[model samples]
Target: MRKNVGFHSVRSFSDRRWLLPFLASLLVSFTLFMATIFGLFSSQNVGDSLSLDIVSFTTLDDFENDSIGTDRKKLLDQPAIMQEEAPRIAYLITGTKGDSQRMRRTLQAIYHPRNQYILHLDLEAPPRERIDLTMYVKGDPLFSQVENVRVIAKANLVTYKGPTMIACTLHAISILLKESLRWDWFINLSASDYPLMTQDDILHGLSSLPRNLNFIEHSPISGWKLTQRARPIIVDPGLYLSKKFEVFTTTERRELPTSFKLYTGSAWVMLTRSFLEYCIWGWENLPRILLMYYANFISSPEGYFHTVICNSNEFKNTSISHDLHYISWGYPPKQHPLYLSTKDFNRMVKSGMPFARKFAKGDPVLDKIDRELLGRANGQFTPGGWCNQTSSDEMAEQCSSRGDDSKFLPGPGAERLQQLMKKLMSQEFRNGSCSSLQYDQTKRDWITPKKPA
Candidate 1:
């Protein structure tokens, strides 16, 4: 009986010891699983790893929610919202020979954390300059980290005022679409162009508008001009040659194209990614037809996209018929607008246009714009809340360190931009701005069509 009792006690103690360890192990497993589930729902900035130090850029400040706008504040306050209302932009800044520095400056002027930019030094530029451009794009720290900005690796020779301009534009768009998935809009600009509004203003303004609306100036071609432009058989050598060449006119001009009515307008445009996707992706045949049609046309960039958008029944009404660029032309209207100077600065500001074209490189007006309009110091990024590295004591370059990118702090520029948005969206201008433009002298922004001659 003594041995039996001793054996029983030993068995009970051993069983209990094993049971305790098993229970402890179960508790630990459950605790670990709970911690993991909690972490899965927590917030994480998507851009923590992705950085784009587009060459020639100085900094990128973490985006602040309040800094963005009022509407974004509510959405950002919630932890499980899982997304931001603020959208991304992909820009194509194209420049010709000797315009490389201006392209860099325009890029720096419009730089932002939520945007992707593709710079193109067209065939008009020397190979050395193109290499310089690529070096700038690849060497920037912020751009390298973000991995957002990229220069066209395979440069194409472009002819001024020819089909190659359109080709280069399309090529850049294709590359941007393939390389990045975050952009909402595709904007094309030239070296002679510069930004009038801040990124904050433009981004915030776009967030409120429908994503389908395309900002392009367009007009229906008719009568004498239609017959002349439609039938012109011009061949561009830029597509075939390895060196600089001009477009040649065949001694033959054909009759007007009855199949599709010709449309002509400003080449500058802000196109939606969806429309660009339609053009790049072969889901529809309309874009393909227009591409072939404009292959031999003069100034095809000015007409290809215009015709494509207008001809497509699906995309016709989506046109806003405004290029969103401020261009001051000579009294008689020359090929390019007069060089913008101090005399045009106030008018430029009051115009409330986000972008302006034909500014001479190294012009003092550009310096004045950088100082007064952009609030940018020499050789630095435009001041914005994204830059936190600046000292709190005064507005300074503080983006040396970055914080959360989800936040935004918009400024007066945003409000003025909103007014411009309101004017564009008003019912009075809706139809007139779309497919039909009627110029109104009272409002410089209003367009009234000239009678068919």
Candidate 2:
């Protein structure tokens, strides 16, 4: 009986000790479970608050929600929202020293209340000229009222032959994308470039076409160009220097890249906003890689975008293979095209191209273009449907009214441009796209147009 009592007491004590430890474990688990639940709830609440803030911000800044107008406040806002309205163009007009007047003239010639314009006077221009350009944009009653025009206060030093030109263009594109403007196409022009037709004509012609089409002239790099452009190394001093200088070529040459095919063409282009977004954001790796590679290539501007679009599977088919500028190159083409004059006017008119380049400053041909093609008078905005059209005060109040810009009154210019578009979109031109080019792996050269069969 004594042995049984002792054993029973010992067993009872051991059971009590085990029970205490089990209870302590349960309490610790319960405390941790409660903490996790509280943390999840707190996190969800914070996330909900942030989501609401983002939603509210996007709704307020959306341009598609409001009617189109010269709303300066909304236009100046950041993080632009694209609108699904009538097609609008965004223009980047670039110039250097002694080009303020020419830039202004080009601006006025291509001005439309519906479109967006950003003028870039490069770093070479004096501060006084930049200020004068800004004042001209601000002081004009029509420009002030429309508010689509902007002068880039900060300028970039551009070497025409180097990547700096491409940088300036991309910088302008980035600014346009940041603004609250809705545009379908992005067109880059220079102080020497002038419109052959009215903005009404251009807008009208483009309205009928697909917005995805990119008017960039491109061809595979081969022959002498491959040796000169693709193999040579050049340095653009404008990249780091404060002053303008010519791009210098290095003594050594690089072997042509085997990973990607090289392409080169006219530097002037009318690119789609979507394609420009791809180039700028680089969600895909191709554009970024090509940009780095082209950094050292000679005449990077002429080849950079061309190579990018041709290599991109998503954007290659969208290329139209035309630059849309009636540029006349000399026999064997001396570095630049000849300055167009009155002698070229007949050819320019018949060419049906919307724009032409390398025109002499204050040329009589510009006066003829203004009077005959654009119906624009001296120091006046190009007359369009947006202009005030009262017979009583025709000349004075010609462009005073900020009328509806979406409604374009296109004339013969539209017909000519339409014909040109038709020709460009024909089967022959469509068949000559980037995909049609055949690459010979053995010879490491692009075969000429595959001989049709």
Candidate 3:
């Protein structure tokens, strides 16, 4: 009798367990149904307030209008003064191990109160070095006061000639976009790169131009380069591994993509913010699709942004077909350009390029550039209109104090850059079959094809 009673009790508990869940679910359904009848679930009631603010749930005009709104705000705020002054530029200065000092020098050379600077030292740099750099930036009174400089605290492991290089660049762009909205252009430079002109000169030269122009060097991929660069499959260990390693090539070769064309150019570029936004936000699918395609391509940095800009319809016409860099290459150019020295200084200045690259650390030519081109005193910020000019006795001390950032003191460097821009925008340069104008090493400037007589 006792055993039978226990069995009955167990059956009753199991039956009641199912009943509780069933009742709970039924109660939830009833509550939801009551809410629905009250119009709580209706689209009109739920989204009416949101709809009033958002022009449409569909179409991208709203997104474009928001960007235009910012522009309108700028126009309303400054009217004519802001339009005449130089546009704010955002710089991504990247370096690796043993490059902290060089990065500092480059940073000082290009420093301006009106501009934004972000420094990135890849994982290859030691933590102590990174910390020291952060301290240097923070310890400076001018940088702390104006607050335009930032360092990437969490650095990425960038593998040379790999997709990681592209990844690091895109990461920096996103951070800059989030931190500031006033910048008009994004320029990428490595520690090895140094500015030939002051920030004032580059700013003044670019002030009159259309803000949308992208100074990227690009040429269509064809023949040998296509076969060698595009067909290979590569895996950058830096993507998965914590430590740095060389990218390995796979035996499997992929066919050329038929959807979008491939373009190649110099790794460095001076891109407009709007184009970079499209690349980063991916309002359309092309940027993402190409990003995946380039992940395995050799030297992705050289081709990723170039391919994206060329393939994009909205941005294609805006490309200026020049990197605005004075890069010297040997005859039948090797994989890397010759390490620049005093010999290249004359040509670098004549090229009218704003910057040059692959300079050796502690090179004597750098000092000469400082003395002649930048007018930057050793370990001092490049003097600009932003530098306070109180007394000649406190010349170095004057730069320590900030002045009217909007004020620009244009110099001879601006004139040189203007001439280069004129040639780049000329009808003959724009109408060429290929957008890339080759460098005439002998002539020491761009070879703009002569107009047919």
Candidate 4:
């Protein structure tokens, strides 16, 4: 039996309960009373733990309506004066050559003074292009003043559709973690991706969540994927050669890992800081073990993090198994999802996903998103409550001046995102974790075993 913590019980004033539970409640009350008489609040203070991050299983509306945790209760009871203590996201936006301008535009659209951004143009981009990106970041008045936006000076040779993608991601992650290390989560995006919600909506929605939960969409390999993906052995030349080359497959095949089950998913992810630390610099051996194993795995980006997370018993239960990106797979499937277009706008907005990917550059569809979906006035940052500049000058208005970074004015995005999270986090979805399946030659699909409750 699990030992119940005595500190959690609330005093029952009007309820009739069993003697055991009643006595437990009385005991908890007495304990707190005694603690108050003395100085025993230290138990709750783990490390600079003054902030009440206990709104999990609760929403911002709930925070307003009810008397919640002691500190949150007190805060809610106060007048609606916003305090500046919101969490910040560290973004690693990577792209290859010919994507510098798109990356720049994406960066500006998502830019906030509070968040850290690391833009990378991989080795496929010529030296001039990389220099141009760095110059762009350095020259921008807002970027220069905030000092949170950075362009990768030393670019990695990222192999298209290879483990190099994950490597480049981790490289940026390591630098950020080592340099500032204050971010709550590390979100990886490519230049092709764009945010569907304002930063205010994104941050406010996440503020109520448990900080440790990782949002990675993943599933077990079955049928076609198991054979077509796992059995193949291919080496990425980006790992050794200066210039990127195609992956070469060996005639040999390998067996699935006995120690850990393999998982696969979308490359886009919003990973928790604690999990990132484990994957990058933890004392544990699992991260390194999986890294070496995936060196020869085709499309390692999909499987690398998935395998490490699902295989570790500790993290499996914690996986929400959703990459949180709005993407549409073509019927019968294709190499990449159908590039999001104007036709997908209504569905995209209703999906409640914070980000969507694979848009054709400067597509008129993007303009529609900017105007209607994101509320970003033409080529401007998403207009949030944080924006305070006068709306006269197009370039120097609204986003030029700022308010408290912590304040939030979440629009429809928050509501949509909350519903999406509810589905991913439901008991049924979580219990149906990454499974082991075998291909049925006749079925021409994965034949999965009956799952146990």
Which candidate gets the maximum TM-score versus the true structure? 3
Shift in Å, residue 428, candidate 4: 2.7
Q: For candidate 4, report its TM-score.
A: 0.75
Per-residue lDDT over 83-198 for candidate 3, one digit per residue giving the tens place of the 0 to 100 score: 55569999999999999999999999999988889999999999999999999999999999999999999999999879998999999899988875579999999999999998
RMSD of 3: 8.5
Worst 10 residues of 3 by lDDT: 73-82
Candidate 1 achieves a global lDDT of 0.75
Question: What lDDT does the true structure give each of the candidates?
Answer: 0.75, 0.83, 0.84, 0.76
Q: Pull out the clashing pairs in model 3.
A: none
For residue 226, model 1's alpha carbon misses the true position, in angstroms, by: 2.1
User: How would you order the candidates by TM-score, starting with the best?
Assistant: 3, 2, 4, 1
Clashing pairs in 2: none
lDDT of 2 by residue, 1-453 (tens): 999999999998877877788899999999999998887688678785755565556665454452321243234222233334668999999999999999999988898888999999999999999999999889888788878898989899988688988888899889888875788899999999999999989998887676767889989998989888888899999999999889899999998888889999899999998889889987557889998998878888888989998997666766778999999897988888999999999999999999998898899999999988988888777888877687633732577677878778898999999999888876577676684433233442323454646
Better of 2 and 3 by TM-score: 3
Model 3 score (lDDT): 0.84
* Residue lDDT tens for model 4, 251-276: 99999888878888878788877678
Q: State, as a TM-score between 0 and 1, how close model 1 is to the true structure.
A: 0.75
List the candidates' TM-scores in order. Answer: 0.75, 0.80, 0.81, 0.75
